[model samples]
Target: RFMDSAKRLPNKPMVVFEGQEWTFAQMHEWSNHLAHFWIAQGIGHGDIVCQMLENSPDFIANWIALMKIGATAAFINFRLPPKALAHCLRIATARTLVFHPAFAATVDAVRADLGAATDTAPACPPWATLVDGAVWRVHPATPPPPSRTAAVDFADPAMLIYTSGTTGLPKAAIVSHMRMTLAAVGFPGMYGVSESDIIHCTLPLYHASAALIGFAQACFLGSTVVLSRRFSVSRFWAEVRESRATVVQYIGELCRYLLQASASAAAAATTDHRVRIAIGSGLRPDIWEAFKRQCGIPEIGEFYASTEGTAYLFHWHRAGAPGAGAVGYFGPLARVMNGIKVLRVDPDTHEMVVDSQTGYGQVAAPGEPGEMISRITNEPHKRFNGYFGDASASEKKVLANVFSDGDRWFRTGDLISVSADGYYYFHDRLGDTFRWKGENVSTTEVQEAFEGMPGLVEANVYGVALPGTDGRAGCAALQWAPGHPPPDADARRQLAATLRQRLPPYAVPVFLRYVPQLEHTATLKQTKVALRHQGADPRVCADPLFVYDAGARTYVPLSAERYVAL
Candidate 1:
């Protein structure tokens, strides 16, 4: 599909990045060269190759090259610590590790651990090397033999995109060529986006939203994409303007950041951009109008989806429309055809409300909040590709006998409601994960990271709602050991530093609460209800609260004044 598109529009601009543009023909030629180089290095069909790189034209080209040889590229999250990075590589059973110069230190930090193969996976091949400018410079600009990719099947794994899917560590979701092809054709047709539309993407290319949804769709539509190294509040509108992007892709947090930064010179820069439609997920209702009006963008296209799940919903917002802030709308016909259900679930335990005798879930009525689930089927469109190497993990998302005997449904792990008018509203995440900085922060993962901390005996992590933020902020309630004292100024600073080194930046707790004891459920499990309700508010919580001061590199007591300032 990509080769045919490139051949048909050889001179069309496919990607624009850092003032450099690559046409379809140029990108194809470069990818061909990369394919030949990797083939020579012994990379073959079905080989798992890992990637750690920032958003760049070469990043996309490298992925294309891997596809040309029928190899699966596992895109590692660059924000992860060395431990998490190693875990991802091991899970993917990657044979080669490829990274850009910017991530050389990160790769080196995990190099020793990756040297030997484990019981479950093989060692990295010795020929696996860094992809520097020198490699591309030395390789001949020629395509590999056609037989290299001829045996590739549509169901073959194309990419391994890691997602923190309501669980403790990141899981590599298997994105098949079939899934990619569907998304490439499905999204553009849904949005009515055409070849003339220029999509501006600031999200990380490692993320499915940017890779499968943004770049793949643009490639399929024969549209141009303006890529950025990272999202910049000040430079965002300028890039969109300069590139004349008709559609700008975003996650909810990016929109909030833009709105927050608009108080400065960025306010003036938001207007007059060529952006007509802003499309992405997590646009909060609180700031939807403000973002569209203040930024001078005419439309907001909000979608609700998961990296590994098959359930998808889209909403195209227009002024005075009923679907302004809703995640999506389920038309009657579409709903029936899709066979999706909203089943009642216990909000506290996140368990489905099922009949004791029949063991079937009770379906929620319209306007009632419930967990949205789709039937698990073998159909190409609705099939669940699941995690790459963990069948048990994948099976956990499938509920047995959902509505009837021997029936199964894919649990979305989201609480949602559909109004009488068919507008669907997002309620809450059903499990131990919450959205922070456009990424899923797993509470269980954060708690596990805090387990061996010197003085901490008990830790409860949860998301706290904050003013002026689209998603929740991470907060951890800590109870010290009997003999250990509470964290002092220096201890707090060192603890913050340790957390920053052990976890991803976004996963680190933004607020800390020192408590004498933690509440528990009747089942003896720790409960976060009280702590989450109190949040990080100093006025409400009896326990001492400290907020992370990123600029100061430590934690400071969150007094009423400090809380108000935040």
Candidate 2:
């Protein structure tokens, strides 16, 4: 693949990372260097290397190195809190980690916690630490290809990725090499990516949307990639203009943020002649048209791909119409299920939901919202990388013995509806995750902020009811340990400062509830259900509750009149 692209279009730009440029030759060399780094360390086939860095040139280099060696790579999100991050690294059982040097403190915090992999992960941090290590020495020479004697089939497990568990513990998804290779080719062809295209990659490397699949598509087409340290709405168009990029890899919320940025209009106007395509997922119906208008983009290639299941959907037919239905391209098995499949039981007997003319409750209609269940026929290119064998958790999302007596399928904890024309439409999503301003707002991330505030010891963050809202509004409930200081004005200031720096504004809790105590589950879990009911109720407690004050740009005491518009 590299030789064909290199020979056919050797001079075309391949990658621009940080401030450095990597043409086809350079990127190929870098990938080879990383592969050599792996071999010198004796990390060969069947080994897993954990990646905890954001999307950067190094991240891609390391990932490509693993791919070349036939080793598995587990990409872990860098935004995870210390505890959550440690838990994932433990499961990865990776012998090496390539990360950013800036996160030294975070890495150090969990260094001792990594039980088995401690020896696997060098005590040295990334970049600054590894740059001087003896491992940096040039390899004697690229070793000869390993013998086929080991039976390293493409069907072997090559990657183990976990879902972005916004609710509880994240479940791991195991994907095979064959499935991934097919997926890689599926994306570029589905989206019409070609050697001439220069794609922008701003999403985090750890995410499935950005690194795993996005990078795959770029390489598959032998297209050039432009990388950024992080997603910066202000700098998006500037970079696009700079690189003369033809396409951008995006997740819908990133587009929304670009639309929301103060300079969106001006920046977009500045680049009237550049950027023709956008390929990504999560573009919502409400903001679809406005997003296209503001960005001056003509074509949108969106795909819906689940981590485990082989099925996916892409939107390729309509150049101007982006993200209004199921993904239309990217792979063959990815298809839209026809109707709402529900079950029926006798009203008195109440055995199950009756499958009559209604054919089990499938939302309002094909166009209306309904449960989206995908068939698991176990196609060759498609495999069910079940949730690491989490039987109950996996079962919870699947509706068994439906439609037919003995058929089993995966039930996306999401509610989707297919149109009369067989186009799938967005309904409601039924899971711990809820979309806010187009971004997946993790409650765990929100609550973790208050856990370390000087005035607080524990916090319970969850979504609350709001009129004319999609899922819920963010609310944080807090309790002060006796010795800790109370949440006063200064503490509120500190709280606000920390959140804005660590999290996006939308993910920040809108309402804060302070109570003498909090409700708990039998396992002593903070029962957010009761708190969710209490909402921003000023009467929930006499202590204090904080609601974001739009006018003041800071949270203020909650009041009855204040919630009128809520």
Candidate 3:
């Protein structure tokens, strides 16, 4: 696809980074040079090569070179610590590790953990032997020698993308050539974008969103892609304006941060840009319409998917009528063809509700929130490749005999509800919903009530353990916008009153803590594992903490004495 695009539009810009630009022909030639250089270094066909670099031109060029040589590129997350970095290379068993000079310290820190290079194959290859990516750019720009080996099959592994590892060590997910090709075709067809469009990508290159959804589509359509080394809220509009990007990729938090920064001088171009559409996942319903209206973007393509899962859901939000903030809308044909099934389950234990007669999981009623599952089959489009090196870890996501004998389904680990009209709404993750007072409390729904609150920028809701309590108690970590005053007694009272009006009594947050900013993963999703463990301990947390007084109907400072009394 890239070769064809380069031949048809040699002068067209393929990648724009900072002030530098590379045309299709230029990048193609550079990739060929790198491919030949690697082949000369004994990196033959079907070899596994580990890559750790930030979002840059070299990253794109290196990925293309790997594809040309029919090698599987193991994309390592650069943000990981030294321990996790070593684990990635060990799991991949790559013959060579190529990285940017900026990460030389990180590589040095993990050198002792990586085994030495040896002729005899061991548990792990010699990842300690590093190759500088800068050296490949100076290689002669020419086409690589034609291979006498057989061509790579469609189902063969093309890349290994690591999961976010929210719970434990990140596992590499195998992405086949067919899957990558489908992603390139599916995103553009769904968004109705063409080669005339210029796409802007600021997400990490190792992520599937930027690599497959952003660059792959550009390669297929011969579209220009503006790449950013990293996402900067202050320089976002300038970059978009300079590149004249028509479409931008984002996660929900990036959109929220942009909206919050709209009032600052840096965001003067918030409503004035060439961008016509914004695409990605995790856009909250409360801010969906507001982001579009405030940013002057006409369309939002919010999708629901995962790195390893086969199921996908899409919502093309435009001219917003506020349709329950659904993640996807399925017509009659899609409803039947997609094979999406929602099954009732215990919110706390995550156990399926089985029918006595059939001994199969019961289907969720209309408008009932439950785990979404997709049927597994041998069809090319419905296949699940699972994790790369661990079969047991991959088997954990498969549920057998879900609805009938010998039937298998892929567990999504997400709670979703489908309206009678076929619109699908995301509720929360399976473990994110906690039981309070014998009733299920949705952190997402509770957090949504905090929207539009004066001085509050964002809220991260979670459940915390309390002594003498039957289950976890509701807690919210709040972050105020820049220059906004922290929550005072009056503000706490107002918050309590509003939450009581918007949520049930049991669902109201029992505690609140103010922070400068919330901790997030590389993709900008808020993480609550550490916050949950800390709970309301004033000794452990220096941030301003407050606890609700049920009788007073307001919140007061949570001192160590107050915590002990509770």
Candidate 4:
């Protein structure tokens, strides 16, 4: 795709990673070199290559390289410990682990634990071993001599996307090249991106909708991009101006981060901003208007999409419509299905219900809240490639025979309502998973990880809407069982150390809430919704919320001064 686009306009900027710019032609060549070499090292199609990397130019280069070999690429969470990394890689049967030099120690930590793939051949080839050291004498390998090629069949699996569920474990969703291409080609047509348009990209490359989709689109559509190592609201607008960007792209909390970074600055008058439009999901209802007003951004076009599902809802036209959570994927024949056939049903059973006010037996009408589902079991346009090797998970996503026998559908697990005039509105979510930092956090998985720790009883966790954050921050209330108040500070410190060792740092709760007793429902399931809503209010449940201080690398009292730093 990059080569074809470059041939059309070789001068167009294809990437700007870490302040370094690469034209379309250069990106394509680098991708070709990486792809051919990996394939030559015995990596084959259908194999997974795990990359534990941060946002960088190399990440984009590696992804395209993997695609050239028709191999599945898995983007592992950089925060994952050695054990979790081994489990995911082994499960996917990853053939090659192409990673940056920064993670040499991470690879060392997991090398022995990688025995999970004992009988299988090597999945990741060591780079240094592949090339002998005489760097000064040898030149970088040249791109392959011109070879024959054909159009990328839309159905080919371009990526195997893994999402951390709020429950169970991470499920790998297969996205086709078609899915990536459609978003690139369709986004511009739908919202207008051109050669003259300069977009600022700071999202991590692993995120499907943001990095891959946006990166591919910019290259294919002849748009210039200004890349940053990570999102910094303090420097966001400034970067846009420096890059002469006309539009800025973002995710849910990124915009909020900008808004909260400096409210007074956002409120300053400036219509001549390098950014005329910004796009992303999770623009909070409460902060949406104020953020736009303060930033002087005329448009805040938000999109809603998930890794597994097909179809996308561009709330570009429906900005501020009270419901805007749709960002699955863009495909042909996709629609909001505002009329009949769109309905919500009992969780236990698929049977539809009638209106509560009137006994009218029919699917939900426009403006009525119902679970958002799509009819695509036999739909040729969107076919899920099954979660890696987990068939049970793949089957779990299907709603069989909803309308009639043998009619299969994909359960979106999202609640939404369509308007009478064909606009769809997001209501709420219905899965155990909640998003944070473009990654899904499984509450059950987190709770399980917290178990077995000394003095830690039952752990209750839920996503609470933070004042200036998208996705629920994991707020937990811990019970200390009678007479078990951490005998000494030594024990408390040990407890914190145990948690850090067992779980990823991000999975660690920001607020360490302690209490003698934790409230729960009649069924005895620990309830945390209210506690989460309250956050760390001192006047309310003053259980002494705490945050993990990375510098000290220990949990400390959640103080306002430190909260600002966190």
Candidate 5:
């Protein structure tokens, strides 16, 4: 694809990064040079090469080089700590580890654990190489000798993208050449992106969103991608305007942060970006229309997909008529062709609601939330490659004999509801829904409600354990809007009242904690595991903790005396 695009549009800019630009020809030549360098170092076809670098031109070039040589690129999260970093490296079983020099200290910290004598030669032939990506741009400009080996196949694994590891250790998902190609070619056309489009990509390159979707789309369309080292809400509009990007990629949290920042920052900072379309997932209904209005971006291409999942949902909000939060709208043909089934399941146990007669999971009724399961098939496009080196973990996501004998389905582990109009709405992750007062509560719904309250910037809702309680109670870690005072007595009372009106009694958060900002995973998803473990204990949390007073109908600080009494 790189060579083909370069041949067709040699002068067209392929990547723009911090004022530096790389045309299709330039990018292809650089990648060829890097491929030659890797081959000279004994890296060959079918070899695994680990990469730990920030979003940069070198990262793109390295990925292309690896793909050209038929080597699987294991893109590692650069922010990982020593133990996790070591684990990922070991699990990938990569013959070579090429990382940015900025991460040299982190690499050295884990060197002993990596079972390597030195950083350069990790007791292996093709060893760890630390390259200063920003400074080291030297590589042969000509293509390397063509391989006498077998041609690369679409079924070959091209990359290993690791899961976010919210529940446990991150599992690497094998992304095949076909999958990458489909995302690159399919999404651009699906989202109405063209060669004239310049995509602003601030998401991490290590993520599938940036690499497979953003970069690959640009490659396939012979378009341009304006790259950022990382996402910065304050710098977002400036970069977009400077790069003259027509479309921007985002995650839900990024949009929330941008909206929150715009509320306080100067209007000129965000007013006039050339962006016409914003694409990605996790934009909730509360912020959807607001984001489009505030940012002046009319089109929102919200999609629902996971690194390992087979099925995908694309919500094109081009002719938007208040469909703020639906992930996607499926026509009758798509409904049957995709084979996406919503099966009823026990909220508490998370087990499928099996029919006694058929011994299969029952399809959920319309408007009722259920776990989404996609049919698995032998076709390459519908195949699940499973997690790398963990067959049991992979098997856990597959449901055998789900609807009929010998039938298999991939468990999405997400709860969603379909309306009579054929619109699909995401409820929450299966694990994020908890029982409170004998009723299931979706943290996403509660969080969205809280975000609607005045002066609230963000809300991270989770269920926390309470002594003598039957199940976990709802707790919210809240962030105040910039320049706004933390929720005062009156504000807290108003917030409580607003939530009471918007949510059911059981769903209303029982406890509230004012935080400066919420912790997030690498992908910017809210992290709840740590907070859930700490519960409402004031000793563990320094934030101003408050509990809802049922009698008073307001939130009051959880003083030590009240804490002990509870």
Candidate 6:
């Protein structure tokens, strides 16, 4: 499909990076040259090639070249430490690795542990090569032999994208060629993207959102994509205006950062840019309307899907808001055709609650939250491909005899509630929900409430283990808005009073920590694993700590003695 599109629209601009544009013909020729170079290096069909380059035109070209030669590209997160990088490379088992010069120090740090196969000995083939200016400089100027991508099977693995590894070491998810093709074609139809549209993509190319949805969709539609090395709140609008982008892609945190920037910075930013649609995931409900209104975006195309999940939901809000705070909308026809089920489960154990008589899981009633499980059929596209090189993890995601004797369903690991009008809203992740004061508490819900408070830029809510406590206690780490001082005594008292009135007593946070900034993963998702591990110990954490003072009706500083007394 990509090659056909390139042939049909050779002169159309396909990629714009760092003030340079590459037409479809130019991109095709460049990729063909690199494809011939890789074929010369003995890379064949079914072989995996690991990638650790930043977002650039070279990264996109290399990916296209690998696809042309029928090789799977394993995209490693560039920010990974040496230990984690080695683990990912070992799991991939790829014979060749390609990277840019900017990451030479990182590659050198792990060179000793890369094994003998990657060494430069004459007896063994070279396993690692730098693609900055040397490899592409030597490639032939002509196109490669007739296209080999056409002969590739749809079910064949095209890429290996690893998870965020929040719980443990990252697991490689197998993305098939058919799935990539579907994202390229399906997303354009979902947003009504046209050939004249120019998409501004600031997300990292290593993520599926930027690679498959942003880049691939532009290619499929014969449109233009404005690429950035990474997302920057300061330069986002400026770049969009300069590139004349009609569509912008974003993650939730990126939008929050934009909202938290100084009014002067935002005032200087271009709001009259040609951005008609903004599309991505992770937009919180509290700031959804505010972000659109502030940025002058007319439409929002929010979608819900993971790298490994088989089911997907696309919410198009071109008209007035029908499904507020919903990841997607399900019409009467969609509800019947998709057959999505929300099954009740034990929140603490995360096990399905089964009926004794029927011996099957019971579905949740309307307006009740439950774990969503989508039925899988014999169709190839709907089949869950499972994780790469990990059968045990893959089998854990499949539930057998879910509704009937031989029925199979794919567990989404997400808790969602459906309204009476068929709108689906995300509640929280399966493990992120915790029990506090004999009631269930959702971290996302708490985080959303925190976003509405004044002077708070970002909030990360998590349950932390406490001594002499039956369950985990709620702790919130907050980042103040830029140029604003930390909360004072009166400000803290007001915040506590507001939260008490807005939320249940059990759901209200018990402890608060103030920091200048919050850490995030490479894909721009706020991380909580490390914060949860650190707990609320002042000796372990460098951030300022505060304890809720029920008697004083305000938050007080936590001294060493005060921490132990609680």
By descending TM-score, how would the candidates be arranged? 6, 5, 3, 1, 2, 4
Better of 4 and 6 by lDDT: 6
TM-score of each: 0.77, 0.71, 0.94, 0.69, 0.94, 0.94
Off by over 4 Å in 1: 116-130, 137-140, 165-167, 265-267, 356-358, 432-566
Cα RMSDs of all predictions?
Answer: 11.5, 10.1, 3.5, 12.4, 2.9, 2.7
Local distance difference test values of all predictions, in order:
0.82, 0.64, 0.85, 0.63, 0.86, 0.84
Worst 10 residues of 3 by lDDT: 118-127
Task: Give the better candidate number (1 or 3) by lDDT.
Answer: 3
Q: List the residue pairs that clash in candidate 1.
A: none
Badly placed stretches (over 4 Å) of model 2 are 2-11, 116-134, 140-144, 148-150, 262-273, 317-364, 389-392, 432-534, 537-566
Ranking by lDDT: 5, 3, 6, 1, 2, 4
Which candidate would rank higher by lDDT, 1 or 2? 1
Give candidate 1's TM-score: 0.77
Model 1 residue 119 lDDT score: 25
lDDT of 3 by residue, 248-367 (tens): 999988988888777554444787788888989888888888788788789988888887787889888878445636888888788878978888987778978889998999989889
Better of 1 and 5 by TM-score: 5
